[model samples]
Target: MAEVTYYTEEGLAKLREELQYLKTEGRTKIANAIAEARDKGDLSENAEYDAAKEAQGLHEAKIAKLETVLSTARIIDESNLDTSKVLALSIVKIKNVKNGAVMTYQLVSETEADFKSGKISVKSPIAQGLLGLKVGDIATVSVPAGEMNLEILEISR
Candidate 1:
């Protein structure tokens, strides 16, 4: 069975957009390149043809990868997500037990993770540790920096 991947609405939209582009403009560009290469020389002796074929191979590989990704996608409903505990699509506020540093992060899909916006992938160590934790609950996570304890303060969205 194909594994199901959870994604937010925005993340799904982005994937759909990418798939559309690959099917349309991306394929067209690759086809054009192949055609140009074919026109330039003897089929077996042409480096341009070889390069174009390689590019086409790479392009199709990317398309197939995207297809697999889209096939497993399951978009999460933000409105139904509970705020009482950490979960996918939840914005959580946590305080570091050792350093007293506070931070907020929205647990999202890998596609939706944007550090600039404080969004983290649910698969990430910190998010994995925070999952199922409620306010006043403490979670321990290990990173390259070492293991740290974080206290959940709030959950929303």
Candidate 2:
């Protein structure tokens, strides 16, 4: 079964743009590279041609994967999201119970996750633990480092 991924409108638009680019400019660039490589050598012993072919395969695979992801994606309207509890697309503020260090993150789909931007994937351990939790709820999340307790401070769309 294909997994359905939820994406914000902006994220979905970005994905569509990327898919269009891959189908056009990206494919053209790869084709040109392959053609140039093919013209440079004998078919039997051309390393450049081989490399170009491999690159083309990889590029095509990426396009196919992106297409599948786009096909199964559902755009989420942020304005309609509930802010009463942590959920996908919810911006959550959490404080470490042990150290009192507070952090904020937006739970997003894997493709839209950018740790540096404080957007975490819904599949992430922390997000998973926080999902469906309300403010003042304590969640114990298991990370590679160790398990830590976090208190939900706020939830917003």
Candidate 3:
């Protein structure tokens, strides 16, 4: 069985929209490419036809993957979440123990995680170390550089 994934409503909507596009406009485009390639000449020696078929296969595979994701995706209810400790969708403010630098990040599902937007994947090393931690708790996380300590300053929805 596929692992169940948690997502915000916005994230799930975006996935649904992408799946719809892949099934509609995306499928139409691939079909047109296949038809145009087929019209070019004999199938046995047509590189364009082969490429189009390959593209179609890849596209179908993507559609299947998206379908599976949608099937297992569940939207989390922020209102019911506990704010006393870090959890998925919780916005956490943390301070570097060694440098005193502060950073805030929202722990989100992998698909919704965007570093530029201050959202980090819950599966990320830092997030993993911070999970279930409360304000004033220190988390020791391992990264590519080395291990660092981060102090949780605040937690919010």
Candidate 4:
């Protein structure tokens, strides 16, 4: 069996919305594009038709993948989360021991990981190292660049 993927409430809601859009608006658009391309005549020489068909194929594949992900998604309730130790969905603040730089990240699932939003995947090196750690604990993460030692400054829900 495939591993179950966990998601925060907001992340799960966003996935649902994307799936709906793909089923409704996205499918309709793809159908219209195919129809318009088909109206241009000769199938053997119709570049537009080929492109449209390829696009439809890609769109359908995306929809299928999204549906599968949504079906297996498990939503986590943040209200019930305990911040006593670093864990999935915990907002952790850390300070780099070597550089004295500080950063905060919310550990989430791979699909919800976005560096721009300060969200890191639980599978990531830093998050994996930080998991199960408490405030004042040291996390030594192994990255492609090298090892980075960080001190946990805070942990919050």
TM-score for each prediction? Answer: 0.91, 0.97, 0.97, 0.94
Clashes per candidate (backbone, < 3 Å): 0, 0, 0, 0
- The TM-score measured for candidate 1 stands at 0.91
Candidate 3's TM-score reads 0.97
CA lDDT of every candidate: 0.92, 0.94, 0.97, 0.92
User: Candidate 1 has which clashing residue pairs, if any?
Assistant: none
* Residue lDDT tens for model 1, 104-123: 99998887899999999999
Candidate 4 C-alpha lDDT tens digits along 1-157 = 6678989889998899998998899989999998998899998999999999999899999989988898898988878877889989999999999999999999999989999999999999999999999999998999999999999999998
Which ten contiguous residues of candidate 2 have the minimum total lDDT?
A: 75-84
Q: 1 or 3, which is superior by lDDT? A: 3
Give the poorly placed runs of model 4, Cα more than 4 Å off: none
Candidate 3 segments whose C-alpha is farther than 4 A from its true place = none
lDDT of 2 by residue, 21-63 (tens): 9999999998999899889868789988888899889989999
Q: Of the candidates shown, which would achieve the greatest lDDT relative to the real structure? A: 3
Per-residue alpha-carbon lDDT of model 3 for 21-93, expressed as tens digits?
9999999999999999999999999999999999999999999999999999999999999999999999999
Best by TM-score: 2
Candidate 4: 10-residue stretch with minimal lDDT: 75-84
Say which prediction, candidate 3 or candidate 4, comes out ahead on TM-score.
Answer: 3
